[model samples]
Every structure is written in structure tokens, then in C-alpha cells.
Target: RLLTKMFSNHLQKKLTTLSTLTDLTISLDGWTDNSGNSLYSFMALKENQEIVLDILDLLADHHTGNFLKDKLKEVLSINGIKILSIIACVTDNPSNIAKVCMGVSVYEQGFRYCLSLSETARPKYPEIENITIKNIISDRYHFANNDALTKVIKPIVDAIGRLESNDSTLADIFKELINIHQQISQLEVPINGLKAHALAIISKRAREFDSDIFFIALFLSPPHKFLAISRKMSGDKIIRASLELAKTWNFKKIDTSLLFKDLLSYKNNDPPFDTPFKSSSQSLRSYWSEFTGNAPLLHRFAMKVLVIVLHGASCERLFSSLGLIKSKIRNRLTPDNLSILGQLRNELKKTVHIKENSNKTVTEFSTYNKARPTGF
Candidate 1:
């Protein structure tokens, strides 16, 4: 009770300080736990703040799309989060996530084919795009259309998945899409003749992310400081994009005098944090940290845009810690108690000075509980 309350109150106070914050990315994903309970996970980040993972209970019986929408609204409302604050919602191509992204399904066919293709033997997609078989020859198209097609197409799919799983990946989507486009262009050539239609279906889905928000995400990242514009864009286009982004952030509106003169001057200049971190994941993490200190405006945009980690991998890892605290013997733990345990453990892990596995804190809690409850 004390542990969770302490950390919960502390974190809430921290979030309240983000009054000026906007465009926050909150990745929502749900899973069935070892106890067969359907629970959801959320990971929220903005600017230079640490990613906060929250495990929320899904008390309803069915997990339909509409139900999920209401549940999420409730969660966000309780946390005082705004829908407009979210830039993107990342999840493994699940139907529910698709529904959440848009009110309805846009890529149902593509999603179905993506799964069927992931397996060893491809599920019969019947007819895809322009390819058809009236006069039957061999089942080559049928058999090869599934897993083999998926294997050939995995380069693009896997790369995008890598981008999705990135801690600070939202900003890299557009740049990475360019990379995917290049990969597909490379693969499209070798895939001539009869198997061409399969490639078309795969390519269409890969190129579906045409939103400008993706490009904005790419532009904010330090490594790809400017999204790889060389393929379809020139220096002129680059300047235009920077100008527009600047305007979108109201940079020009704030200081209208030197709109082009101020920002465009740094146009081609390289950010000191451009290079990749050789070993640490925190390499990219450091870029925002450094920029926020010196450039608060750009930092705000970076925070507004950088968001996503769909598989709930971070949240799942959190569940493991929760498991340690609320073991089988402690299985009777209430949701409130479990939350405190989870948050307290998370708080402990965040600070190196606070020994996580140390018995001192646990012993102190034990002493306090025993002393208060006893007649002594």
C-alpha cells in the first residue's frame, strides 16, 4: 500500500509538470497472462522523459474493437491524457490495433495474407491482385504463394517490425519506409514472371504508410536528422520541408522575423549527435537529452513525436518483476497491492542507488506492518 502509493503519487506529480507537452505517443497493446487474464499494457513517452509502462486491467468479458476503444478512453481519461496528444499507436498487426488506428479495417486482406505467409506452408490466398489461374498447370503458385512468398518478402516486413520495436522508433518511420521502398525495389526485379502478383500484394502493403506524420517523426531523429531525401528530393525540397516543419511547430509564428534566415541557416549542418551509438541503446536516447537542454522547442517536438514499442516487450518484462513480487504463494494479492508492487519495483530499478533486490526496504516495510498491526 505504502510503496505503490508513494511511487504513484510521485509519478503523477511528475506527469502534471508536462503541462506544455503535446503530441505524446502512447503505445497500447493487450495480452493474456499466465493466469488466463486479459490485461492491457501502455507505454507513454514525450520528449526527454523516461518511458512509463502501465499495466491496466481489462475487466470485461469480450475483447472486441468497440469495447477496446471505450476501455482505452477510460484509461486515458483517468490518467488525464488527451486523444489529440497521441501521434501514433503501435502494435503487432493485430486486428484490434488496426481498428484502434482507424475506426474500421483498412488492411484486412493484407493482414490476413501477412499471417498466412509467416508460416511454413502458405495458406491459400485464392487470388491476389492481378494473378489468376484459369488453365491449371502446376500448384507452384499455390504452394509458393504462402511461406515461400513470405520468406522472400520478410526483408521488408522484418525491417518494419524492427522499426516498430525501436524505443524511439516513431521518428524513424518515414526514413525507414524509404529504406523499405529501396529494399522492395531491389526485390521486385528478381520477382518477375508468374510470382509477380504476390510481390505486388506485398509491395502495396509495405508502401501503405503514406502519412506526413511519418516523415515528421523521421525528421526529428538525430541519426537521420533529416529523413533520407536524396532518392526523391533535392536540396530545395529539404529546405522547404524544414520551413514547413518549423511553421507547424509555430516557430515562424513565434519569431516571424527570420523564419528562413534562422532555421535554414542550420539546414545542411550536421547535428553533433548524428552518428550512431556503437554499443548502447541509450545512444539515440542521449540525442534528445542533449538537445532538450539546449533547444527546448525542438525537444518538445521530439517528445511530441517519438513514441512506440508495440509488442509490449517492455511492459511484459515489467510483468516478470510483478510476478516476482506477487508469486503463486502471494497470488491472492489484490489489484491495488499488485499495482503498488509493480510501481515500487519499477521505481527501484530506475535508480541505481536504490538496490532493487535488497532486503532492507522489504524488512523495513515488514517491521512497520507488524508494529502497527500489533497490540505492542
Candidate 2:
């Protein structure tokens, strides 16, 4: 309990330092354990920081949308985390779309159909009548159906993996989603099989990428701004929305009219910087950092909004670390101790600057010797 309190106190200090992040994107992810325990983890992402806000193991008989919404609101209401804006949400279970993604419905039908088999068609025994069914015939029929459908659905599954990959950023999702839709629409399914089912599943999700937060995040990226804006909203409307977002944050030194004019006339190929960055290897973040003085409000907005991760993989990331720590040889490690160890690991990763990590803390510190080392 003392250690948990210490971690909480440390979080408060970090929260105070990050108070300037008036705008935040919340990622709520839930996972179920083998023991039927439903656990929900909440994470908050800002311009330069990502932290696990809280973890709750709900004791409910079932998890529902109202339950999720209330728990999310409760976590953010504390922790000095106001302005609860959600840019994206991901789930192991695709039952609820609920402002999560623009077209989350596109992804739901495929999942729903997987569980729609009628009770009578499914029986514990191979046959109910006296005659036993031919096992080979039943197996082959299912295999043919699965083969046709799997070919279509595999790409969409791979696309989800890429989008949620640890290193992926918010800018990566838009193009991948568009490509998945194209692939889904072109699928040729068997006349009476799961191919059509598979197609509908992906096509539904493809068209659901309609969230305004998605467009704005993609718009902030110089490489994607033009292609990322939703056709539903005009270019002028996109500009207005971006500016309105800034005003809500009470951003400093924003000449709203000037910013609008500047964005209208801006060209990515010819950035305001004196030296054009030629190599495609140059990142958009670097470009925005250099252009801050020229377009202060615009730069700040891009820095904040574009920094969001496309998924909440960060919430589950600690599990891998925990697995390593609590291996078969060390499985007896207590939960509280494991939690502290995990926090220590993450807090270290966020260290900004380190002069000499291995330096001695006592009177004298030894540096790496330039001279030969033969082991004394």
C-alpha cells in the first residue's frame, strides 16, 4: 500500500508538470483473463507523454456501454485530467462502435456473424437420429467455406495488426483503412458461403472511419493533410474545425484569420524553412518544430494532435514485461511488487536527459578508461 501511494504521488507530480496539456486523447481498452475476470485499462496521450491513467477490474456480471462510459468519466474526473476528449478507441471485442471510430460498424458484422449459429444446427453429438453423419463430408464442406472467406479476411486482420503496432503513429491509420476498404469491396465470395459474410464485415468497417478527430490528426501531418481530410467536410470547413479546436484550448498567439490565410496558401513541398528537406526520411515532426516561429499556433496544434498513437497497444505492453519478470522461475512475485517494478521500468524510459547512467553515486565516479583494459 505504501509503495502504491508513492507511485500515486509521483504521478501527481508528473501530472502537475504536464498541466499545460489542456487537450488530451484517451484510449480505453478492456481485456478478459482466463478466469473470467474483466479488466479495463485507461491511458492518456498528450503531445510528448503517454501514461496509464488507471486500471480497474470490474466485478460486474457483464460489461456494458453505460458501465464503460461511467468508468471512463470517473477516472478522468480525478487526476487533474479535464478536457476528456477521445481521439480513438480500440477493442479486442468489436461489439460497440460508440464514437470510437468513424465507421466502426464496418467491422462489427463479421464478428457478430461468427457467433450466430442456430442452437438446433449445433449439437453436442455428431448425430441426433439413428444414422451417424459422415465425418469427412462435414469437414470438407466447412474447409471450403473457410478457405474462401479466410483469404478475404486475412488482409483486414493484418491491417489491424499494423495499425496497432507499437511503433505506429496516428498518421499511419488513414491510408491503411482506405486500402482495406478497397480490398474488401473487390472480394469474390462463394455463392452460398462466408466470403460474402467476410466482405460485409470488412466493407462495413472500411466506410466507418468518419470521426472528426481522425481527420484533424491526419490533417496536421504535412504528408497527409490534403489526402486525409474527409470529403464530407469541405476544405474551408476543415480549416474552421482546426482553428476552433485551437480556440477551445485557449492557445496563445493565434492570429485566427492569419492562420487560416497561411494554411490556405501553404505548400508542403515548399515549407517556410530556408533549406528544403529533400530526403523522404525527414519526419513531419521535425518540419513542424522548425516552423514554430513562423506559425506558432499551427505548429503547437500539430505537435499536440499529431502525437497520438492510433491504438492503445501501450496499455497491454506492460504485460509482456510482466511476463518476463514473473516467469516460471519467479512466478511467486506478488501483484503489488510486480506493479511497482513495472512502473519503475516505464518511468525510466521517460527520462529526458542522462549525463552518465553508470556513474558512481559515492565520493568518486569512474569513467570508461581510454587506456587498455586487461582485467586486473
Candidate 3:
């Protein structure tokens, strides 16, 4: 009981700190354990800063959307967060969670198929052409009668520039921009011809830019993160196509600066950085190794990694710990007790690792009786 109370207090403090921070991205994953525990984890990063993992919940059976929604609400309630600060949700590209229908599927299918198929059979996708009409829905981008494609592209162009930075590569920024384009393009109804114009614009920008430093810097970061984004977004298709296109364009080799010698040595020695391994499974490990074993392996490697990113693997690990902590005597655990156990497991895991320059402290100090020491 005392251990449980202490854990609850620690969790309250952690949530309070996170709530005060601005801008957070949330990622979640579901898992099943050997003991048949169905678990979910929630992870948050404040504006690309500190990481917070909340074990969120564990269940006896499989998870569902309503369960997840309630878990999210529970976190919000505990932290006293009234509104979401930022909303970047990262989930696997193959997640069936997002594809589930919330309403009557029959009605929705009938509405979209009935009239639309008749129009589409004539090769007239009202859905596709509606894009142009939607653009005219507002004359905001129009001067006189002609639509200004330049005006439509400026914001997207600027976003690409910000995303470009020294920290990202042509491959990185290009993939992101193309994803934005794909999303706009994939909208059920073409709100405007804006998407068609946007893709052309991004493609032009990618080809014309001459920035080698940015690409090199991007490659320096561990390739694992690239896999996470690509896997979650299905943005690998965009990257694969971009890299192929890049081969045809001539650009100056990115300078390696002072570490040129070291970089070259690394290139010669290490088995070139392959795509990140997604799991301990033998098939995925073999698949990644063979798929990424090549020069200019960046695009292929990223594709393999993104196919298997998981946000909540660690949290699910804690639920395993919970079973151990609860034991058979405590099998019928209360929600409050389980929550505390999860928090304690997470907090204890956060202790920093000591390395080469480990801090040294004297465990024992020499003590002297002043008069006796003087006489001696």
C-alpha cells in the first residue's frame, strides 16, 4: 500500500510538468503479452523535446478505438490539460485502427457510389473535376480572370524551405513535401486544383535546389528515425520515387568539412548503415540486411525500417512488469493500484546511465577526534 501511494505521487508530479510544456506530439501502440494481457501505451514529446511515456492501460482482452479514446481522456484528466497543445499523431501505416468505420457503412457506401459511379462511368469523375470548381469557390487567388498558381504554391514552398534546414536532406524534405501533396491530392473531393499545382511546384523546387550540406547532415542522424516517419506515413513511396529522380540530376558533392577523413574512413570500414532493424524476428532482420546492402542505400534502408516502427513497445514491457509486481495474491488488482505500479516502473526506468566520466563520490570519509588526533 505504501509503495503504491508513493508511485501515484511521483506520477502526479510528472504529469504536472508535462502539461506546463508547450506543443506535444502523441504516439500510441498496442501489444499482447505472453500472459494474455492486452496493453496500450501513450508517448508524448513536447515540441520535439523531452519524451514522456505513460503506460496508459492494460486489459484482459484485445484493445479497441473506444478503449483508446477513453485512455486518452484519462491522461488529459489527470494532467488537467483542457485542450490539446499540439496534435501530431504518429501511428503505423498498416494500423487498422484508423480505417475502422464509426458510422453505418451501408449508408456511406450507397451515398458515395450511387450517383458518383454513373458520372464516373462516362470518364467524368465529378470528384476529380470538382477540384477546379472548388478553386473558383473563392476568387482569393484570382486576379481578374486567371488563377495564380504562384499564390497557391508560396506557403508550400516556404514550408519546404523550413523543413530543408541543415538538419534534413533533399530526400527528407522532398518526401515530406510530396506527402503533403499526396494528402491534398487524396482528399475525397478535389477542393481545388491546388493539389495538382502543388506537386508540380515541389518537384520543380527539389530539382533546382543546390544544397549538399543539408543532405549530408541529414544522413548523419541515425537512420532509425527516418524509418519511423516513413513507416507511419506510407511516405516511403514518395522517397523511393524522389531518389530515382535525383539520380538523373547533377549536383555538387556535399562537403564533409573537417571530418572528411573520418567520414571517408567510416565509409570504407563499417558495413554501410543499412535500414534499421524493426524487430528481433529473424525474417525482418534478414530482410533489412539484404535490402539495404548497397551504396546510396539511404532510400531502400528507410523503406525497410519504416515498415516496423512501434511507439509503445517499452510501455507494453511495463505491463509485463505489472504482472510480476501484482503476483497471484494480488491478481484482482484495482485500477488505482495498477496505475501506480505502472508509474513506478516507468520512473525507475528513467534513471540515467553512468559512462566513462562517471561521477565519483567518497562513500566513506576519514573522521578525527580533534584532541586525540593532535596527541597522536
lDDT tens digits, residue span 208-252, model 1: 754454544554554564544445454456446655755655554
TM-score of each model, paired residue for residue: 0.51, 0.61, 0.34
Pairs of residues clashing in candidate 3: 231-306
Report every candidate's CA lDDT: 0.53, 0.60, 0.46
**Candidate 3 residue-wise lDDT, 71-143, digit = tens:** 7778666666554353344443332232122222335446446446645676654343566654643344233
Using lDDT as the measure, which candidate wins? 2
Candidate 3 at 100: error in angstroms?
A: 30
- Candidate 2 local Cα displacement, residue 370, angstroms: 13
Error of 3 at 348 (Å): 2.1
* Predicted candidate 2 versus true structure: per-residue lDDT over 77-97, tens digit per residue: 776666645443444445332
User: Best candidate per TM-score, number?
Assistant: 2
Model 2: runs farther than 4 Å from truth?
1-23, 32-38, 46-50, 60-145, 182-201, 221-224, 229-231, 252-254, 267-293, 318-376
CA shift at 177, candidate 3, in angstroms? 17
**Total clashing pairs in model 2:** 8
